[model samples]
Target chain A: MNSTPNEQVPLADNSIIDLQEVSIFYSGKIAVDKVSFPIAKNKITSIIGPSGCGKSTLLRSLNRMNDFIPGVTVDGMVTYGGQNLHGSEVDPVEVRRCIGMVFQKPNPFPKSIYKNVAWGPGINGYKDSMDELVEQSLRQAALWEEVKDRLHESALSLSGGQQQRLCIARALAMAPDVLLMDEPCSALDPISTAHIEDLLFELKSRYTIVIVTHNMQQAARISDHTAFLETGKLIEFGVTDQIFTRPQNQRTEEYVTGRFG
Target chain B: MTTDTYQAVQASNINKRSTRWAEFLIQSGLGLCALVSIITTIAIIIILGKEGFSFFQHVSPAEFFLGTRWVPLLEPQSFGVLPLVWGTLLVTFGAAVIAIPIGLASAIYLSEYASDRVRSIVKPILELLAGIPTVVYGFFALTFITPLLKGIFPDIQVFNALSGAIVVGIMVLPMIATLSDNALSAVPQTLRQGAYALGATSYEVTTQVVVPAGLSGVMASFLLAISRAIGETMAVTLAAGATPNISLTFFESIQTMTAYIVQISLGDAPAGGIAYQTLFVVAGLLFVITLILNVLSQKILMRYQEVYD
Candidate 1:
């Protein structure tokens, strides 16, 4: 089943999700061309590329997030633990439950902080203590301490960074096995970005994390595995340290070394 | 070279002066345009107050408010506004019952489900409903809707509150649907994506996230549409049959406040007479009811306004 020509494809002990030669097209135009990479279980994988180079487009395909866009077409296969995500038998709603996403901007629902976390689990028919679930998810996203007292307050009242964390908590409440982030920290300040980076480092121990990031250093700082993409193609995929320090593809080296986008 | 610089500066100053003059002129013109509505409102208040206050002298406030009968021309005329108030309320309530579900469904369909092509084709047709004359709607209620109701309930009158209300509801449906659609569309796309990412089905997202986010706007639209229905004149007047009978039955002919004013004013009620005074008094009363509704709705809207940025 392994058809990629690259010999340096790093295989992990437990790969929870895999994109096998997946290409995405929006309205007959190719956004990501034949990009395949394995997202190892319980590890942070960061996809880095210049803007409009299809990093986000590729990341969105994992949970069938691109299905929301009209005229979007996905080629090849995205699989979660050997189950095809795009197969007719798989419901996108169920797929999204297993593989949740956090977007570029912090889009907390215009609701109370409590509702923001509880809504996901509540809608998905969580029969246990909703309050406990909400608090646990918030704590997991590193937001409970700051937001515990004002749980009923509007989520919009929180700061930009806090809102981003709340969004993460909202995603976590669904108890997803894998979390896909589309430049989640791109809209935050440097301090907020660092907090999220640290949170991601801690989160990888439990949930498989794949993030598309524009910041090269942030990717290097937090990600265990890094996938560098250029012009809709996967330039290189390897351990973060190796990709940053050594040379494989000239483009990946150039992109990581501050030489070229 | 210095003279050339001086000439350029002088020319620039002249251009600046003209620009300032143009700006001042345009600013004042815009200000005056805004003031037109304010001035008109003031004038209406003055006119209605003068005549409305005169009516109070002829009839005591307690009698006008508490009394249920509203006959101005008869010898034993009673001018209690309760019957008119009940009539207005009944028609408005009936209209709301018919309008809210249909309007919101159309709004949701237009906003969440419709493609660009479908939206383009459907939106103008809805707007066309708004453009149809209220008089035409009145005739529609009288000629078409009343007969249809007569079929359902054999006891229904030729001119009845139900028919008037149903037609008014149809008349205001465009407003509710259009404004509600705008409100729903105003909800950001990212929020919908965020909900979808949380494994919510399209139905859940529409009902929970997108709808709640745009709730204030939808509520505001509903309030505005209700106000329009309350203030509706011609349709209610023609279909409801201006008998001023204060019955609770929907099939019974009743007279709304607007209909009362029209009936009295058109019948050549002498100027400054008790009958003529009823017109201003009822108009003033109608004005107060709608103003309170608008104010309360605005306050609620402001309180729940969800700023997504």
Candidate 2:
């Protein structure tokens, strides 16, 4: 029996990533069933679902970050720039360089703010002026004005909201084509969440973004496209406005209106 | 309020009162258990201080700390402790050279590279090195290491500082590795994932992120291992010769403070004699050094600890 229905949204012409019948497994048990989607370039795409619905598992597979977990196996294909990410010739490290990620919790290295932003590019042998790169990335993340004077202080000294923005700046330093965020603002306060949401809107012009969020309102507000997942299956996918206000599936409708998860 | 509900509330209050008395008694019992160790420590300090004061009357502090000669048991006795202190430092420095790099490398491998099945099997075997008796290590140094060194360096003494340092280094290897491995492992997985997400290679993540994150704990482990090496008695007493001469050459025979204490304790130094009094003074100095090291380790751990949620 087909677990995923044939209700996929129309593929975008400038899709940066394509997941074709991708199914993820932990040990032998399935976590993400056969799901297919196209991540449009320079657009914000948010995956919204109830807890344990495989949104995070699906998001991690884009950059092959799931390879770090023991006993994890992926079936089918995830392609970026006509190259299969999980191919034998491909290096996961290089893949991650082109597809940066922010975690559910703010996890800056125990380093100065400047060092946190510079570490990624420095380790990859960036030969450019590190000072300029650090400034540019922090500016892009909207964190430069507050932290400019104290760039040498430890990242841990920052508040929880500032730390999350610092993590964003750290990821932006790599200049990845796509940025994947797993509930990046969940640990933050309301003001911080609003700050990040505004920042995401500005980022949409440069990098393709894939976010998994438990907050349905956040997905409705920031995302151009939304995918509703339930029990490891994609229930519906379309423009964010359509998915939230005029969802076709019963589960998506029920979930959006606060009827049931 | 209903009479029945009042009666139920009163009965529960009486029961809670009885349990509170039992809780107080249990807490006091636990406090007494903790106080026992503190009392014993204070008692030991008092005894050592009284005896050390008498020893200081016979020997001046300036001479004991600065004078080069040490001949307490022989005639025309000179109580200068420089040679013994120098010998102990030499052995400790040599042992650190042998152990630190190897122990830290094995710790990195265990914490970062080894699979679960491999780690489970190998970690206990590595730690088994610590469980072996120090006496056996002394014998191993005398019977095996000395002969091996002598063949390489024909001028090497049979009871040389080289053999003693090598054995002591081996004795402390498991401790440094185990403690360092635990510290490295305790670094949160999220930090490692954060590094990897930045396209860091495994080596880069382990060295730059994980190692630096666990640096405080790793440093504490190193300091504690050095303290253990300084206090090591049985192995050094048997392997390092009882010659109190200040020399930097590992091929020459030397005597550490621990070895000196063992020598005097076994020999017929009459009770209450000056030679007997030297024992307490030396032991008191050793106690102070170890205490300082332990306190420094604790301070480093507390001051630099990383908090993760």
Candidate 3:
């Protein structure tokens, strides 16, 4: 764990989540090699990698979403605020509640727009004004302006981008501490991707965000810190500007430059 | 041109012609199969219509429909179809009450919780249950179920609607279970993942998200099972007596529509007589009832269908 000059910076003090040599295996096949990185509090950290490089595996491990898969196993420690996430006593359900996720494809429930936003909170026993909470969440996700008049309409009625935003709002209703995005913009158009990227910038100030992306420029544009992965191995971890401008590892340079991935 | 290239070109042309012929053959085969089914249905409807009209002429429509009794063979024959209709409805209703809950529960378990090995085994076993002959089920109902119920309740009749209903319920269980399992499994994996990511328990994900999304298919399965129960003949005829009584008690013996048809056809009635014509009339009524139910159920399903595509 030797610290490089960039790693020596005081930003490490702001780390809200710490992964210590975390490795994941599915049915005895390694999907993520021992990967270690710090996620800064209230900042966007992006993991960029080619397809099948285990970037998504690493992101899903943070909230124990991999537990749902058969024969999945994890080694090493992932700690959030001094609590081990994969510890024997840790409840995966509680981990998911505190760490909400948006999927690659928009998966808003086949329900009304209002119910989609209110469902998580409703199930978790939110006793306050549900209408106010739903409105606030949609407003935060930047979807309220277009759908405010038809809150009771089915979420499937919305456009793909709107539905993605509605999914984000659904997660926001849970009031999580961390938000995980697994290529949330891959299914969207450029304009919708830009809308989501902008929304990420606004959201990071309130929630610690970790995003996995195949798009190098997106990682550069929206992330404060970047971690590049190649073939289940972490190639380099540093500040986004440094990683994009002056990557130390040859593989990182090759991947970020689009010469090879 | 080289000889190899010339031969390759000729071979490709021959292959393309054969492929076109194969495609045309398949299309014609499928079309013929569909046409056969259509023609059979038309022939049945025409025969039923002619015979049903003749029966209505012998007995007034009001007496046939509103009559409270159904003795068409003895002196002063009463052709009131109310008792028969009531019996058919009671048996169908009783079967539904038994099947829906048990079938749906098994479907959820098989689709959501069963391991792949367990599913591969159990699913075929359910299909085998469907493959059982209806006559065998009738014998089992008469011998096993009736005697068992008699032990539990001394007042239980040997030939009662309850026994027929239970056997028919068992007969239709495989239909409901298999179709419902298909519906549940057809729910996209993404929806389940979305609910789990939102911290929903497996129960919550299944009952709330998966079931609601697959409701249209589930409802269709229920309707199909109901129709099968209504049209069941051999088991109801053997287990339930041939008396068409309008009593509400399920313990009493009753004759369903199919059973009545069986009774008259087995008797020594003259050809083209009122007794003979009653078979076609009752069959037509059954057909119209089932057709209306199917159409209404389809309309209900379409209203709630969530098109994932």
Candidate 4:
């Protein structure tokens, strides 16, 4: 199992992910229309858009999340590690195991905090030193400090913000290659938002991260690269500072300024 | 002068109206129906106590508790409740064994697997099973179910606990299924979303999240179903024979407590006869059993309640 973090650059540079002419449709209604892009290895990609945009849909498609819904079909290619994701003989369960997702709302199981983090790793059968791994994952997510003493407490007892971070920690325990987060901090308060944003900054070095955010400031502050989407279409993609300071598309400009959130 | 006289007649008159406090008293009076309920309960207890005491005067309490022979009309007239109690337990256990799996599976399918149109169609049909007259259920048990069983098992007695248990299972299935469905459906959608987001298959989520969280509700429904089975009389009387055999075999004829009460009531015993008095004692026993179960169910539900949606 030869694995490299920087394998998604390009053919010359060995890009880890390649998307070509990919479109997502839900019963003839296009959710992501003809979007093609390459995600660099170990770099954070933030998708910013108003509500109803297909940022999350695009992120979910990358991992075959849309396969669960009936009448959802993807027309195009999504290459991960030089393999087509939607190809036959490809199990979505395997794909999910590799590319895990965290949702907008916190969804901690009605389980103990330690058990919550141990769940994915245990199911995937990561043998040896499980007790240590759970601790390490929680520490990495910055949840261990506050919840370290109460690892046996029900995950529901935590504040809303803590639960979301616990969710992040749980995903990390799965040991996925890419982490897809759909508005992870939109439901948290300001302090908790800053904490999660900082955690994201810390996480990008180890994992390829794709986050969908509604907060322009969050995108500007935390993202290395930002893609703006509108009504299931990619409007623009560029460096975060460049997208905020200068814009090529009117829709992108209108959205970033809080004109029509 | 005539007009002034008419004005004087109309003077110093105020329409009578009920005060707000009087209205409050009227509402409070309606609310005190709780008192009426308490009084009815006390009256029932008093009546049962008197009748049960009179039964003990004729039949010793030790004999009632331990004696196996239950010949109420024979020359010696040995009055023991153990046979009736054992019979009640046999049928109730049989009903529960049939009800639990089928009822829970139906609930799971309805809440988790079925589509809305199917649910809408299936729910009322299930409720219709509950709404069928107990007497009709009795007749169905006797005329249809018993003969059907006899076809399958050639030696099954025409009147046995199996047929009555099956009918009662169907009758109480709706209660358990509907209650459990409500509980399972009440589990927050977020918990499910969380499981899915964690890359869990739908089967995993259903087993891991939905089932455990809904367990308390399912247990409560089970207890309630047991209570209903204990209180059932007509179907058991018709389908299960009046032999008062303390047997566990479903293929053989048996007598439940309810059936014995019905049997006693249908026949004329002297005003203070031991058999006549046993009905109250049996009723007391049934009341105690149901009360304990209800309390246990409430305790589990209240103690481990998942408060947040």
Candidate 5:
């Protein structure tokens, strides 16, 4: 019974996965309503909106993190490469293996830095070169150079920025096809945010990126495409520059101009 | 206002405030009470230490520690401590064996697995167990547990270490669980969340992260429970027999240090006699043992600490 996602957005090619009229209900309360969108493959697609707009909910649904919460029911079909992700035959754990997530706050286990990166690969039964894989994952997350000397230290002993990068390394160790970032830099200072932005830019050439950001400026800065949502509804989706500078929808323009949230 | 004017006004306010002696008197009263407790403690130590030193004069320390035979009430009155000491240790260790696993698991269940609704209901019931009288537990052990064990092990003695240890175990189960549960729950939720995010299941998170993080406090609480079991008198006196022997068999009846005290007290020993002095000696031993354990636990807590940011 809530407002719907924006309708005039260009759908992702059939080459990528698509959502059709996806609705999420948590304990009889609507979280995301009839939201339909295609997550572009191999591009930095940023979901930019104010807080409590179901942006994180939509991101979590992509990886089925919502499954952890009780009393959450979904009504819609999410097809990844034409395979029904929500179907009974598909395990949510497998879906998560394919689609990795990085949360707003960095959560590193109370383990060594090496173990933190090695966890995902070990769980997935990567039988060889676990040390190399840990190093490689840290390198991929652009954290290896700083942490290579202290791989035995607890991951939590790192600075906030370092810990966030370690979390990215942990997720990257999973080697997922797609990465979902929920407000990755919302908790970071500018220099750290810049480091992550540069890392994401480097990553997008190989991995599909879907980032949720409260910072509209961050959306305009690093993203290729931007989708604006408000009050559990998508208001606009377009090229990042167009969404920020010359928005087609009135609500998008208002949000972009800081006139309304 | 200028800086000088501000200081003047603040100074006036401070001077205007009441200089009542009532606050000082109340504070001094509390300080006096604390001092009383300290002095009473010192007095107890002096009294016990004097008698314990007297025991050293009658019997060498080596004989007390190493000698096996304990015939303190016999004609020669052998004052060897090995039997009583072994009996005390056996009962304490046996009690710990019963207490550690069951108590730790209950703590984990209460802190981690149980919901608020379950906790609110279960904790009060567990607390009720703690309120049960030790003598009642002694009676239950003698009547109920002894028969149960005898049914299983047909050759087992009616009043045995097994019975006493089991009863003492049940008696302190509530304290162990409650203290350990508090310690475990005191570990921050962030650590747990971090563990879960690493793909650790709930069980792994509990055993690996939560328990290790709270180990020091848990150890302190464990030591405290051990001391409680050692200090327990009535239960072991009734359930475990008065026969003091340095034996390892669970089938034989054994007496504990506290039990020996009770046994001696029940006899008619005139004041100022060596027997009367012996009472202080036993109590002094018990007090020192508990104090050392408490201090050791505190030291352990200080050493192996877990700090969360």
Candidate 6:
């Protein structure tokens, strides 16, 4: 059921990030009202909502990606490792270093496949073998075997599915503690979406993941926890099975049953 | 079929026929406009070839191309075109040295760092530099920049390659900045976001991702500006003296291919003589050089576009 705006959702002890009464505004217009939730460590958490429901806005705030937007203001707190992410002392660049992201569309740099994977660690002064890192990251994203022979080829030469996986590999190269995905499979075909969904499931074992998806079935299939949102407010937060099978709120049930968005 | 339906179909067909006719007429009109430019270019090439062939008949191709000394007007006329080519290249290179780094840096600032408000206010002022007449820039070079250089070198000549180079750089700077800014700005926002999401700082994102992604555009702008500098006449004619000497230092006077063309076209050279025919030959060479640069720029642009698209 929907909790009070100021009340914190009870989270597991293994929670890695906690949002407390977070509200986001763009040009003084509220996009996400006061909402509180916890993202568990090494678990996949899916945020499900219809279009314009602040899912992406909330996800972007997790890694301070929202800082790039003009006139964007985040009230309340997003905490990671006991530090407020929005604290004046916390640098957004460093915040992104710890928590990486994948966008809705595949956005690979116009570089070779190897460089695309190595760029993150290289810029961060990885101080290790770049070749090894690129291989390991690609292997983790399940793209190494397909692109191993052509590591020096342009990343643009890859197919859409391969490009999206390359984006995942690029993010994985940073070796961040968490990965945020904003509808990472929205532009993909069903086969590619399934491929990415499987990749996310494997990635969750190593990195905590927060995904915003419009696909209810995807949330039910892979996520350990699911949060249903409507009109900038969290409608329900519970285990994925229970939310889909026996949603406590009427709107959640209606959305889950495909009766209405 | 119903009679009303048949009539409606006939009426629709008539409308489509009229629309097709109008579309054909408009398309042909546009085609004619395009053909006019193509025909003009061909005509220019034919005329240049005819005059250049006549000029080459008197002066051998090897002498014109390989000779180092170019004295066409005086009695002991030895026409080696290298000096003019060297002068043109020297000024173009100097202008490039001044403009490329400064122009690219400003483009990066405008595209990546500047806010929309700041960009709008600054870009127009930068482009205003391009609008000033080249004649005015020539005088500005003669009166302003030469004096400034003299203050530095003290022994610098009144009319020297340095002054011409500086003015030409200023003249072409706005082209590089505006075109490079457009190219940099055209880089998809998603690519920038991708780099930022990878924990790149703004500087790293600009240099590593955005700049590299937009490099073809920047290179194209550089080539175009270089070509423009090569073709510039009035500014170089006034600032760089008519001596036609090939020297390494910018402190000495020199004459570019464009300056020679201007000199001959000023009603001094007798018609139907070798001195006058040299004008067409030099102009032909300048045209070929610019054409090569333009073609190379377009090739780079097309190659990069394929990668991005």
In order, candidate lDDTs are 0.89, 0.91, 0.91, 0.83, 0.82, 0.91
On lDDT, the leading prediction is: 6
Give the TM-score of chain A, superposed on the true chain A, for all candidates in the order listed. Answer: 0.95, 0.95, 0.96, 0.92, 0.93, 0.95
Off by over 4 Å in 2: A1-10, B1-32, B306-309
lDDT of 6 by residue, A1-261 (tens): 121111243555679999899999999999998889889898888999888999999999999989889999999999999999999999999999999999999999999999999999999999988899999999999999999999999998999999999999999999999999999999999999999988987887799999999999998888888888898999998877788887899999999999987
As for TM-score, the candidate ahead, 4 or 6, is 6
- Candidate 2 residue-wise lDDT, B1-309, digit = tens: 899999998887764334577888999999999999999999989989999999899899998889899898879999998899888888888888888888999999999999999899989998898999999999999999999999999999889999999999999888889999998998999999999999999999999999999998899989999999999998987888889989879988999999999888997588889999888888898899999999999998886664543
For residues B1-309, could you state the per-residue lDDT of candidate 4 as single tens digits?
Answer: 698887886674455555689788889998897689998999999999888888787778899899897778778777787888888888888889999899999999998889888999999998888888898889999999999999999999999989989988878899999988988898887677666666777777788788887788889989999989989989889998788888868898888888887887877566566667778998888888888988988887775564554
Per-candidate RMSD, Å: 3.6, 4.1, 3.5, 6.3, 5.0, 3.7
Interface root-mean-square deviation, each candidate: 0.5, 0.5, 0.6, 1.8, 3.3, 0.5
lDDT of 4 at A208: 80
- Report the lDDT tens digits of candidate 4 across residue range A1-261: 012222232322434677788899899899888887777667777898878788888888888878767688898999997788999878777788888788898888888999899877776678979889988899889999999999999998999999999999999988888888989998999999999988987887788888899888888788767788888888887766667877888888988887887
Locate the minimum summed-lDDT window of 10 residues in model 4 chain A.
A1-10
TM-score of each: 0.94, 0.95, 0.94, 0.87, 0.86, 0.95
By DockQ, the candidates rank as 1, 2, 6, 3, 4, 5
| lDDT of model 5, residue A3 | 16
Residue A166 alpha-carbon offset, candidate 1, angstroms: 1.2
DockQ of candidate 1, scored on C-alphas against the true complex (2 decimals): 0.87
DockQ-based CAPRI category assigned to the predicted complex of candidate 5: acceptable
* Ten contiguous residues with the weakest lDDT in model 5 chain A: A1-10
DockQ of 4: 0.39
Error of 2 at B183 (Å): 1.1
Give the fraction of true interface contacts kept by model 6: 0.77
Interface RMSD of 4: 1.8
CA shift of B273, model 3, Å: 0.8
